[model samples]
Target: MTVAEIKVIAKEMGVKTSNMKKVDLIRAIQRAEGNPICFDTHSRENCGQEICMWRRDCN
Candidate 1:
């Protein structure tokens, strides 16, 4: 997703997104949602969290 869209989601999660990179922002979002800070780390490998919302982007 674009930074703008990520920022919007971060805002809803009360995370400060100013100057945050995409991976960092995604990690923060994952933390807020009680998930692992594993955004973009899939590297095209199969991730165990099959229902992850970031699955497509992570790969």
Candidate 2:
């Protein structure tokens, strides 16, 4: 994945994207995408136009 995408995911996850390791970010994203609860709580359940699950909140 690209750095920009990682950053975006990190941001959605309420993480400091600029300071996170790529490996860690990737893992968080995978977990968020894998679970509906995390995705809904942080990523997709938002009312705003931009809704992204706390990509790290799953695992």
- Candidate with top TM-score is 1
Model 2 steric clash pairs: 13-54, 42-53, 43-52, 43-53
lDDT tens readout by residue for model 2, 29-49: 656556332333334434342
- Local error of candidate 1 at 7, Å? 0.7
Q: Write the per-residue lDDT of candidate 1 for residues 1-59, one digit (tens) a residue.
A: 78789899999999999899988888899999988777887553655787776776785
Misplaced by over 4 Å in model 1 are 43-46
In Å, residue 30's CA in model 1 sits off its true spot by 0.4
- Each prediction's whole-model lDDT (CA): 0.83, 0.53
| Per-prediction TM-score | 0.81, 0.38
Clashes in each model (backbone N, CA, C under 3 Å)? 0, 4
Which 10 consecutive residues of model 1 have the lowest summed lDDT? 42-51
Off by over 4 Å in 2: 13-18, 35-59
lDDT at residue 14 of model 2 (Cα atoms): 70
